[model samples]
Target: MKYFIITGTSRGLGEAMAFKLISPEHQLICISRTKNNDLIAASSHLDYYEFDLQNVNQIEALMEQVFQKINLTNADGVYLINNAAIISPFSRIEQANSQDLMDNLHVNLLAPIVLTSSFIRLTQHLPLEKRILNISSASAKQLLPGMSAYSAAKAGLDAFSSCVGLEQGVESAAVKIVSVYPGMVDTSLQEQARNTSNEALTTPDIFKMVKDRGMLASPAATADKLISFLLGHSFHQGAVVEDLFL
Candidate 1:
């Protein structure tokens, strides 16, 4: 049996991933701002925690409470999946407010870093095979005219994860860090990005494009692939794992 911690379990990819990881034999701890009734009604091994990732200072306390409840430190291995993110509706850089950009940074970049750091510290006594999978975006690689802040933050996160992987190797720890770029999916964020008033947005008619090209995959499909990769493949083979067109 394996223990897993996943964030943003209320909806979208996070929700799908949580359900994918649930089974009679494994344990799943899901965190989000609101409780997901589906996950709550699932197996007893599934647990849920309601916390706002925007409140960065409470993350450590929240983790402590979760570990205390699950007794996770005694486990042979743990998987920390940082899958939560926020995208600003503002399309243009000038149109984006300072606070909105900062909020994006908090949720997208800072929160993941802090959580991964905490995971490393908390699992210091655990055996090898502990993994930290960071959900990233292709936007980090290509510049989208409208999504400046979101793209920048994800890029920072990718860089941070790469550095963490190197540091772990140097420390002779078995903990592996992987930054994954899951291709665009049919999610609310896509809807919002498509509707945002960004004149220079390169992803013109985002919803229509996704529909026309049949490019958007279901969240469940993406979740399944991610779980398969995490369990069956070695993420340490590469610092950044690209899951495009999967």
Candidate 2:
């Protein structure tokens, strides 16, 4: 059986991914802010943990509870997707609230690192292939106004992934680390962006284009590609594993 531990599975791209991977052969553990009855009713293989990623103090204990559901003895593979994020307080660097910035860091940057470490420590002896996917953004590469907090957090995630990959290479561990930049999907994040009161921010205009021109990608389609990559079902074997973005 394959194991998948995904964060932010209650809605949007994360929700898309959770439903995409459900199967008799796949055991899913979702971390979210609320319980998903539909997901639980979908299959016995589905399980979830409802907790805020912003609560940095409880992550360790939470992960312990998560691992209890996994059947490591019969596990064929493992995957971790750090998909939870916040789009609030989308303001310029100076105008951003201190509390908002801190919250963003906790959810977007720190949670993934904590979860990745937990996965590595727990699965070291499992003798199964493991993959880590960090959901990143185009904002990480460009200077977009009003996205200072989001941009900084995602850029940090990408750099962190690279460093982890390098360290693993020296020891030759059987693990894959990637940061995926899922192109603008038709998600609620857009709604949040559009509602921001920051007048200096240009995100609203971009979001408007996405909505009016029908340029947004479907989360379900993106989820399929991401899961395919994790399962090593890709057609392009020569592609750099570090560059996969759904």
Candidate 3:
């Protein structure tokens, strides 16, 4: 059976992906800040963890517990999808609060790095396929005025993925890694941006324009494409891609 360890499964694209991946042939271990009753009622082949990712100190223990749910004797492949993120503190760099900045960095950047490190370390000896998919954003490549924290965190994720990809090349059982921009999905992150006051942002119109034109992709559709690319043969290891599934 295939195994999937996914984050932010409480809602949005993560939830959509979880719904699509449910089957007798796959086992899902989902992590989120709160439990989704719908998800619980939908599947018996899944394990749910209501743990916050921002509490980076406890991720190692969490992963230890997560791995215990898998039986390697019957395992076909193990995958880690780091899809949790926060798009808050959407203010000019200097105007943003220090606490918010730290929280943003911790949630969006440090947490994934630590999780990936733990995932690789824990699964390195296993004799099975392993892959890591990091959900990135276009903000990583652009210089948006109010998105410094989010952009930097995503950019760091991309660079970190590249570095990890390089390291994996020398290993006999290298774990594949891909950092992808899942495109402009109609998620809470977009809502937060659209709701932000214009005075706090330099490019506020961009969000407004996207919404006005209905340019955002639905969470279900985006998740469908993302999961297809992730599980398909076209996935290139260590690639930092933008709009690849589109």
| Candidate that would win on lDDT | 3
Counting only residues 3 or more apart in sequence or on different chains, how many pairs clash (N, Cα, C under 3 Å) in candidate 3? 0
Error of 2 at 37 (Å): 1.8
| Whole-model lDDT values for every prediction | 0.81, 0.81, 0.90
Q: In model 3, how large is the Cα lDDT of residue 167? A: 87
Query: Which sequence of candidate numbers ranks them by lDDT, best first?
Result: 3, 1, 2
- Residue range 1-246, candidate 1, lDDT tens digits: 688999988999999999998887678989989999989898699888898888899898888877776555556558889999988845687877888888899999988988988888887666656888899998898776777888898899899999988777744455788889878888877777767666666655765687678888889998988887777655672278776434
Candidate 1's error at 197, in angstroms?
Answer: 3.8
Each model's backbone clash number: 0, 0, 0
Deviation of model 1 at 246, angstroms: 8.2
Question: Deviation in angstroms for 14 in model 2?
Answer: 0.6
Residue by residue across 1-246, what tens digits does model 2's lDDT show? 999999999889999999999899999999999888888888799888899999987888888888887878898888888999997668877887899999999999999989888887887666787778888887788767888889889889988888777655533344667776777788888778867766777778877877889888888987877777767655221122434553
Weakest 10 consecutive residues, lDDT, candidate 3? 198-207
Could you estimate the TM-score for every candidate?
Answer: 0.92, 0.92, 0.96
Off by over 4 Å in 1: 72-74, 170-172, 199-204, 244-246
Report the backbone clash tally of model 1.
0
